[model samples]
Target chain A: MTGRTRRPPTGAAVLQPHITSAITEAVLDELAERGYGRLSMEGVARRAGVGKSALYRRWPCKQDMVLAVLSQMSVPLAEFPDTGSLRGDLIAGLGAVHDWLTHPRFVLILPDLTAEAARNPALAEAIQATIGTPRRQLASAALHRAVERGELPAGLNLELALDLIAAPIHWRLNVRRAPIEPGYLEALADHLMRALGATERH
Target chain B: MTGRTRRPPTGAAVLQPHITSAITEAVLDELAERGYGRLSMEGVARRAGVGKSALYRRWPCKQDMVLAVLSQMSVPLAEFPDTGSLRGDLIAGLGAVHDWLTHPRFVLILPDLTAEAARNPALAEAIQATIGTPRRQLASAALHRAVERGELPAGLNLELALDLIAAPIHWRLNVRRAPIEPGYLEALADHLMRALGATERH
Candidate 1:
């Protein structure tokens, strides 16, 4: 059997990257305009200039489609680098969060989807599995590294620390819909360092 | 002129307290089920057993009606009582936020409305004016009281502090969708005391 014919049943033959990009953009635009509660597969298909079968081949249903697209868009947005000092790492982490929250498309789509998830139990579970869990795990790595470097206590409350690290920025941008001013990330990181019981490096 | 004839045009006779209560309940129920984007005047009126006129009489449109109902329900949820110390005040304030976020109806409604507000500029403005501004002003008093008591620095960043005060709890409840542990509030308050640069009380 040739490698081309033996390709896994991913339907890679049908689901081209460029087509996937088009569908992804359409999903976001539709979600932004109509919200998750109002979003329909037909609308997405129409907007993406693809047949319903094209979407079906990729995802079983609307919920799966939305979750898959959002997971791809979100999971990589907050990359916490090893900046040596915990303060530097936190500041860099907060900056990543700030950038992701304020992204032109994301700023609109996220709050709406989160709101939708509040009312949809199945959707909520899907979000936690795909978006929330993975994002938290990646972000938790920075804190784990800080602990290894003797920057934080071994008995550190990792769950609470993770919450503290991400929540403030999320609240400001998503809930309050407020703008982040100059030096806001630095100030927030410093405050968080104190809050987490970490010794200041500088 | 009789006092009845000269009564202000508030339609107080038609908008009796009991009727208002029914309408308010209906609005909340409709919002919880259908969300802001899908909520309609007819649905609310039908749920309340009132005519559409009853709703329009209260507010010019659905946006105004939903905003009024939510504002009445929310603006009072975050009352910051003076506990005579910064840590005490913050813990008390965090408890209030935790209660509001976890309220059965609000737990379902707030995130949905916040999402809708992101897309609807008019709704966002009304919410800010009616809900966000009043809530912040009330919570801010706790910090001001701390400053007066010399528990906190006068140069404290009030806006950032306010964001810090509420964000973590809001994040844990609304975004993370996780259960807060038994000692979470107290722990959060202590951490916040450090973050806000307030001296520990005990």
Candidate 2:
């Protein structure tokens, strides 16, 4: 279906928002079909009904396109509402992670991209710069808030704590492909609070 | 280096152990070079200096060959000596996981194989059946020993506990590409015991 011929976008359709969204969607479709190892700008352009120049103007390389699309998709999803308690915030935050990992497009895209990143150092750097660092910062904001509110130890290892919050869910949903039973997030939050030495407000 | 032509093995070198080890090593080399997506039986045969029949005799397809090689490499590495206490056993077990993820061959092989497994259901099943199940069983045996020693609650959720042990290290070392500082494992073991509600033995 992605290989079907289509008329190129008109001059007016070359607007940044229009063409950028089309290209991003096309990249996701291509990744789902071809996986990241085989994804090409040519393929995305064809799939988006745009010319190669349109893609090249936007992102000079596949890594750029992939990272741009991924960051756009994931960064906003990383934000967790201030739920007033570390327990509440963690449960809310991990629930968002649960939804994202179980989402159909992400389920297909992440493993392939992660695999490609392992082999390509430039892409790895791009991913960390664009996706990994920003997302972790957003997640860490919650812990910073918790520390300010006297809910956690000031000396908490924020880096390790962030990994603790996200990794088990990822390992279960992505690696083990297991179901997250109802109330799992609450239990996980409790375990995490204990692991990080969080104290509840009186 | 893997692309260099080699003289075919002599009739004497076709002995089972010799040919099997050569093919298995070639699979790791090919996986590290070409990754699982592009690896092929022909490449393995060429890399191993064996006839294609030598490969077909062992595996019906590329996935089979890959899973076979990975199983051989990982299952033995999964063995962790029982260190008597749950804390000691966990530290020892997670250390093995840390080592395997950092090992050069596995560092290259794991992500590619994981990505391939995400796309191919049969390969996923083969991986889970061969590598995942056996490795988890070995890890679980340590927990079973701990439970017998009365070091953990009888109601411990073995699956979640296992995920807790492995996920942070994987996320840190593989996903985030961060360094595991010295003494980190000991601290991680301490945190894990608390997270799992272990009753420490004085």
Expressed as tens digits, the lDDT of each residue in A10-122 for candidate 1 is 64555577778889999999987877877999999999999988899899999999999988888888678888889988888888888888877787888887887776778
DockQ of every model listed? 0.68, 0.54
lDDT of all predictions: 0.84, 0.84
**What would the per-residue lDDT of candidate 1 be over residues B1-202, giving only the tens digit for each residue?**
2347445577454565666788999999988887777789899989999888888878899888888888887778888988888887888889998888887788889998888777777787788899888899989988999999999999998888989878888887777678889999998888888888887666
Write the residue-wise lDDT of candidate 2 on A21-133 in tens digits: 88989998888888887788889999999999998887778888888898998888889789898888898999988887776788888877777778777887888899889
Angstrom error of the Cα, residue A135, model 1: value is: 1.1
Quick one: best TM-score, which candidate?
Answer: 1
Chain A TM-scores, all candidates?
A: 0.91, 0.90
Candidate 2 global CA lDDT score = 0.84
> Lowest-scoring 10 consecutive residues by lDDT in candidate 2 chain B?
B6-15
DockQ (model 1, Cα) = 0.68
